[model samples]
Structure formats: structure tokens, C-alpha cells
Target: MKKILFLFVLGVFFFVPSLSVQAAEEFLYICGPCSRNFVPIAEDVIQELALEDNVHIKLVSCLGACTASPVVEFKGEIYGHMTKEKLFALLRSYFTL
Candidate 1:
């Protein structure tokens, strides 16, 4: 019984590290008001770049940048006046796309 318990503990230790080694996923937050225009664009970019598994798109009511209606928050940095061209450029630089 003691040997079986020791083996179980050993197995858990090896398994947990593998779970932590997975690549971190990135989150893109788009403003609700601007989602009408930006969601599709974001979806297209992710699909085109085959980043569906690594990137996630979320819609929020606001990022408190209404003047810059189409705002997006990534990696805790807020970007305003978002455009499809700019998004492509940003992602390309970060993701090596």
C-alpha cells in the first residue's frame, strides 16, 4: 500500500510540470460598441494566421476610450483607434507572422 501511494505521488509530480509547460494563450479585448466592425476583422486575422488556438477575442462594454471607439486591450496595454491594418501589423510584429 505504501509503495502504491509513493508511485501515485511520483506520477503526479511528473504530470503537473507538463501541464505548466504549455504555451500561454493571448487575449484580445475589443470594445462592445466597436465589435460590429472589429470582431469580424479580428476573427479573419486570427483565422488567416492560424492563431485560433493561441489567441482569444473577448468583447467588453468599454475600455473607457469612447472617443477612440474602436479600442482593444492586449497584454494589459490599451490601444485606441484600432484599425484592421494596424491590428495586422501589430500581430505580425508580435507573433512573427
Candidate 2:
């Protein structure tokens, strides 16, 4: 009984911190229908950066900006009219890469 309790405590110590770390990572959201054509390019940039672990990418339906067709938001900042160069620059600035 004592051994089981010790093992449980050990497991919790390792598991809980990892969950928090994952939650703390940066979140990037791309407007799907609004962003239209730019979504795949942004995804490819994320892949190229190997930022799969460091950043969480979410595909949202719309950012409420129909005019800003290719919109992306990161850390509460809205970026619109994204080109591959612009996306790369943003990722570089965010990651300091």
C-alpha cells in the first residue's frame, strides 16, 4: 500500500507539470474560410520552422474580418493579407529565429 502511494505521487509530479507547459505554449489561429488560399502556406511555414511543439495552430472559421481575407492572429494581434514572406517574418519575429 505504501509503495503504491509513492508511485502515484511520483506520476502526478511528472504529469501535472507537462500539462501546464503545453498549456503555456503560444497559440496561433488562422481564419479558415476568410483566409481561404493562405491557410496551406501558413501551415507549411509552421512545419518548416519545426514549431509543431512550440506553437499550437488552430483553424477558426472566421476572424470576423471578411475584408481582411487572409487573416491570422497570434497572441491577440491580428495580421491580415498574409503572404508567404509576411508569415515567415511573423514567425521569425515570434520565435526570434
Model 1's TM-score against the true structure: 0.71
Model 2: lDDT equals: 0.81
Candidate 1 residues 1-97, lDDT tens each?
A: 9999999999999988887855458999998875547898888988887888888999887788888857998888888988888888877777876
Which run of 10 residues does model 1 get worst, by summed lDDT? 16-25
Where does candidate 2 clash, by residue pair?
Answer: none
User: What TM-score, over all chains together, does every model reach?
Assistant: 0.71, 0.68
Instruction: Name the runs in model 1 displaced over 4 angstroms.
Output: 1-21
- Cα misplacement distance, residue 8 of candidate 1 (Å): 19
lDDT against the true structure, per candidate, is 0.84, 0.81
